[model samples]
Target: MFTTVKELTEQSVKSGLPLSEIMIRSEMDTTQKSRDEIYHRMEKNLEVMEKAVDRGIHEQVRSHSGLTGGDARRLQTYLKSGRSLSGDTLLQAVSMAMATNEVNAAMGIICATPTAGSAGVVPGTLFGLRKRMQPTHDQMVRFLFTAGAFGFIVANNASIAGAAGGCQAEVGSATGMAAAATVELAGGSPEQSADAMAIALGNMLGLVCDPVAGLVEVPCVKRNAIGASTAIVAADIALAGIKSKIPCDEVIDAMYQVGRLMPAALRETAMGGLADTRTGRELKQRIFGGRAQNPAVEEK
Candidate 1:
């Protein structure tokens, strides 16, 4: 098991380093990379994602793809407006992106750490915290570190991929990450951070991946935003010092169990739920190709 943030913070204090620095150091150690290397890797990942989105948009236009145009445009608008996009916008963008293969926008957005197609939820929650609290750089970094820690735990113990663990992995993991980050930002103890994570994960457990198509557009994007908002709410409640009967570890285990019990058709394969409907099949045929139309419609 990982050490609590409180223990780590105390060690940092004893060592005369900032809490954020200590947290970063801990993460670096866990990943077997130096702090500079980790930072550089994250920066490079972000840059790559940005380039992918740009190329994806161009490809979509060139291919005359029927993918949702609103998502990329909305994200661009939100970034350009100088005012943060509402959580709703973020959610809608992610869900829409998931339902289409248009330039892999959903994957790109997830790379942005917004919600993960599911991307908007985590970033939206962080953005909300930034607007509401205006914390210093160190504070923001610490909060992100705390969030990352929880994410690592989830990745290790449960899952984060919709294909592997259903929507619970994507949305539930984002919610847990955001909840822990929120608690840390709000000056809650390490235990509180864990509690927040538990609450978020518990609430989102067993969420099915019901994308309207094999694409990452429709409900995936919007659901991310909703998950992000809920993470914030869960964190707020945890920060109030209310403890749950179940521990964070137990909640994570429960999520894993639930995910395993989910049907294969509901795991983002577009075979069940919303993805199996007549409308969904028609949409897929229109966007991709069909049995009659050369079956090889290349995805942009």
Candidate 2:
């Protein structure tokens, strides 16, 4: 029923319900499903994400296109070295984010936090938080529902599809959702959670969906890593009493406008941005056997 972050937060505050419970009730009301059914479904999603993160970090699986792999393992090793300048949780989150995306690239099972292309942020942050928060299993599941709450608003008010709103809509929204959920998990208020989302989304407002070789590798995986890292920082900012001047809903609307203004080549068509770089073009040719230019665009 809530269509904006302001409305969602106000409702949560007024009803004395956590954002996650509000989201769960919305899902139940919309689908006419029992609370147990909805919670079990989300639990299954969490299980899948955990497995994918475990598999990605522990194994060396390569994508069929040979575009991306192994970086997640490398990140994990780096994190264990005690030499990384990044904070422990931050590095772990980036690694887990990379791990999840690597699994996606390898075509392994992953729960699309919102979408397959930007699936890494939520689980990545959650698993990383386990090392710090040691949350109960049920608490972890609630984290996901909290994320779902923000994601629901974003998808309805703006977009979550890269083909529609570019990477800002995908990784951007995922990171924003993760940041909001992170605030809640860290025991921040619902208002702080909303501020976290606003900060995260405001920072990632104009990311383009420029997948090289039409594969969700390359920049996509790294972008997820960056998004996770950014989420942690944004959560910190919000929890520290800093607030976004532009509200969350307005930021999302701005992201949608920016995405609409983006050229078609920047959207998922792979004709611009990094997709058109020399190395990117060569890699595409090496992988797909040609430029793989759109036939209609070629004709036009």
lDDT of each: 0.64, 0.91
Lowest summed-lDDT stretch of 10 residues in model 2? Answer: 291-300
TM-score to true structure, per model: 0.73, 0.96
Candidate 1 Cα errors over 4 Å, as ranges: 1-23, 30-32, 40-115, 291-300
Distance from true location, Cα of 67 in model 1, Å: 4.9
**Cα RMSD for candidates in order:** 5.8, 3.0
In candidate 2, what are the lDDT values of residues 56-149, reduced to their tens digit? Answer: 8999978998888999899888878899998789989999999999999988999998999999998999998898899999889999999999
lDDT of 1 at 153: 66
* Candidate 2 segments whose C-alpha is farther than 4 A from its true place: 291-300
What residue pairs clash in candidate 2, if any at all? none
